[model samples]
Target: MADTQTMPVALVTGAGRGIGRSVASRLSAAGYRVALTARSVEDLAGTAAECPGETLVLPGDITDPAFVDQLYADIEAAWGAVSVLVANAGAGVSASVVRTTDEEWQRMLDLNLTAPFRCLRRALPAMVERRHGRVVVIASVAAKIGEPYISAYTASKHGVLGLVRSAAAEVATKGVTVNAVCPGYVDTPMTDATVRGIVEKTGRSEQEARSALASKQPIGRLITRDEVADAVLLCVTNGAITGQGINVDGGAVPS
Candidate 1:
């Protein structure tokens, strides 16, 4: 159990669904007051309802700078200070480099790369002043291993890792640690959409399509949302883990 007296407040972006929702729920259960942010108010509310500690629902797009500023302000006013910031808002686009449009590429960078950087920039001042903080960015396996039809996503995640490494170095001596968790093919809404795409493209049943995708991993199954959440929890709770992109990929990439 987290110590209630020192129980820190956590702000998680993209907390409406998938790994984000799992992370928020786990943290709240561990006695952290959690602030949940996402674009869908209903989904955010549902996530908040599952949490044990005080939950603040702030629905907005993390890619929007103005909205992100407002989110921080709201959290600050209510929570007094943010001890953990989870940059978990990101999306994937299916397109090869040639087929990917400028808009698609920009959108991927905005969400997966720029959004995390912006949040870190805004959160760092307060964290530094307090001489303590934890920042965890939910990156992807594609960051290290390039995947076909996900060039934008791969590039964006790679950029995210770069940001993590740089930030970790900058704040290492200041009582803050920055790290990333790279998850492969988790059973989430994003994976559902990918399964649907495979079905549409190959005339396969949904189950078959999902199976094919899962088979790509050595474990022959998709990682669960809770599994990914466990990894994020490790990064946030462990003080010595910094500047590391811990892979939760079911041995998809042998290290």
Candidate 2:
């Protein structure tokens, strides 16, 4: 319902909930007109309520090429150019390498890797042409390190780093900075569902599985959504930094 097209515009995929919602809220509070896009309109509505400025609720399956095209077109038509793009829409599947089906692997890549690619493809041209833009991908710590049972998720997150580095290199000189925020275990509905899966599969108590997941981080707790959002805020707001994956993992994958 926001009609302010002249304000600086931001497009946040997966902006309905979780870290995406936090990013959108932060950006809106910082005076950008935010576009919230996710699969659920109702979820987007919740995020929209938190934004301080004008908000456009754009709901769709970002993995579809057609939807990506229209999303960019609509944003451009409405707001002139997309100033910030937070490619935060992704999903993870838990499976060992040998037990993982081709369908599972492909699904992970389609959403985590290729969907961002499509968004970037549509978003970058305007940024490149204008000589000003920010691209932030919500990657995972699985990108930098490996895990035992989630081969598909790990590989896809790794692929995200490749995309981030290559694109950042190409656009670094153009005033369009590209980077990623890699989180270890964030407290979100997604993580809750993951906890449920662990309980179901391993027959461990819910509390034990949750503890085990949090134990990966030296801080003995899951990362907060706002913690991840802070890194993204820097990536999009600061012009100098580029081609990096800032880990918000509480020393989980330290050097």
Superposed by TM-score, candidate 2 places the C-alpha of residue 236 at a distance from the truth, in angstroms, of: 1.1
Please write out the lDDT profile of model 2 over residues 98-184, one tens digit for every residue: 999999999999999999998988889989998999999999999999979899999999999889999999999999999989999
Best by lDDT: 2
Write down the lDDT that model 2 would get.
0.92
Q: After the best TM-score superposition of candidate 1, give how far the Cα of residue 228 lies from its true spot, in angstroms.
A: 0.8
Cα lDDT, all candidates: 0.91, 0.92
Worst 10-residue lDDT window for candidate 1 reads 1-10
Q: lDDT per residue, candidate 1, 21-128, as tens digits?
A: 999999999888999999999999999988988899988889999998998999888876788999998888897799999999999999999999999999988899
lDDT of 1 at 171: 97
What 10-residue stretch in candidate 2 is worst by lDDT? Answer: 1-10
Residue 68, model 2: lDDT of 92
